[model samples]
Target: MNHIILGNSLTDWLIALAVAVAVAAGLDAVKAILLRRIRSLTAQRASRARGVAVAALSSTRLVVLAILGLYAGASLLALPERGQLFAGRAAMAALLVQCAIWGDHGVKSWLASPRAQQAEDPGRATSSAAIGFLVRVLLWAVVALMILDNLGVNITTLVASLGIGGIAVALAVQSILGDLFASLSIVLDKPFVIGDFIIVDNALGTVEHIGLKTTRVRSLGGEQIVFSNAALLKSRIHNLRRMEARRVVFKLAVNHDTPEPVLRALPGLVEAIVSEQPQVRFDRAHFNGMTAPAFSYEVVYFVESADYRVFMDVQQEIYLRIVSMLAEQGVRLALPAQTIHLEGRPAVLPVPLPQDERVAA
Candidate 1:
């Protein structure tokens, strides 16, 4: 078929180019349709990432078909190195398969795991996806090394040289590697998972994501704080999300005009109010003694819900009831105030009735 007819001594290059383009286009269409069918079948069962990965790998079939078509056309035209033409195609397929493996296995599975379940962050997710892609690249290095060795490259010598150089390289990145490994520990130990409302040192936030070398926290005020995994692993993390209930303690001032009889009755009233609440438990209420312009009673209770709004609602109801009861007993709550004087008219009275009065009486 080496008949030089269409031009000045050439085997119809225009026809070859047209044929290649047409074959590539046909292969691309076939791949698109085939992937749609395969994915439709896998849609009901496989995880999203895995399904996408499978589809992506299937699409690479077009490249394979196009290359085969080219080789076939070339062979008919008596082209050179036809055996090695298929070698490059095989390598390309291996590379694609490697990527598919990472997307399907390493990354997608981690994303599917409960340990990685976090509050959605558009930016943080993009960052995590980038990191996942990088990890896959590192994994691809291993695959590439294997493929090179299979192609008759000297692996042992190459690996030895790389190992020597990698030591120094590793030294430079030791801190990063430490954090990465710590992140892995975080995933495995799972002392605190994502979406957990945690306080690490002074940083309080809901966990946004756990990444390769850092854990991201989205604060209550809509700020993002990135903590190194190493520091996070060592620090004290108070996970409020895991708490069954939150303990709240505060002092409610009693009216100075409230007599000792009413002050004594106050504890029972507070207890009754707490008892009526659904999830609030009464602790001891202490008559914490007289204060500046007011007598203070320390009330302590545990709320059943960790929700801040719920705690506030319960607190308001309990206090409102206490105020109504105090009014019934002719007691008004004392406001914070100070007694100013132009001159010292009279000294304050000493309480607890000095023991000397007992003997004198």
Candidate 2:
């Protein structure tokens, strides 16, 4: 047999080939063992951390092992300097790519975690997806820059250009980016959730959908109100759904001529009326004070439910009962009125100058 083949001794070539084969086979065996262990662990206790680690490690095994084997074989071969440099660069690039793949897998696993799903507000899956996409983009961008630098490219200039371009792009889409960030904040902070009744400024509605750039609300008037997420965040928001109970304060006015006994009984009447209603907890009822033309009474109560409809219904029923009770007692609701007096001869004798004018006419 020839002692040299392709400028390398036959013995060296055989040894290098055997080493490469052994490394590849050994890596395959290790991969199988690790996969088996991961499966067993998952079966015993499924956890996000375990899944992420396994996913990251499993995705890159084949590529990493191949690169390592190739590197070992290349080192043994009597190759030219350029060939050696090219092989090294190739291996590095492959490793970088494998690392990016693992990062992607990890990100996906984290997004799918039970904690993330439970803690995130409704529609947070979309936000997680966007975040994963951005992470992957950034990872690949860094990997590309590193690869280019290793290949003798002027990466400093390239990085500077990318920076400038990114700045310009950001400036151009500042509004969109603002809304995007606001959406992310909404998901994280949970200011409100889907089906929540919210009032923003003068607009009142139920949250229907929360998008990346806008939030859709179904208003009381039966139309959809769409506001940019950034602008919506800027407005004062009243999340009615978060209220544990509804407090209601109302006033009642009766004619001042009402009998003193009826006036005294007014508070008890109001309390009784409120107590009779379901979901209502009476606080206080008192003859608060006297107004210009009536005696005023104030009533305070709370509705056990946060539902606006329920509150209104209970209030209406209470009002009806109060009106009925007052009618039965012959008490009348007060209306606005004022009294005028003709003091001292009609307050100037209806302008005495007018008498002179009338006589002349």
User: Best candidate, TM-score-wise?
Assistant: 2
Candidate 1 lDDT trough over 10 residues, lowest sum: 114-123
- lDDT of candidate 1 over 20-114, digit per residue (tens): 77777876787677767767777677666556555455536445566655644444443446445555556455555545564546464454433
**Clash pairs (backbone) in predicted model 1:** none
Q: List the residue pairs that clash in candidate 2.
A: none
lDDT of 1: 0.72
Task: Give the per-residue lDDT digits (tens) of candidate 2, residues 75-174.
Answer: 8999889989998988888778888888888988888753366334544655566567778789888888888998899999998998999999999999
Measure candidate 2: CA RMSD. 6.8
Q: Pick by lDDT: which candidate is best?
A: 2
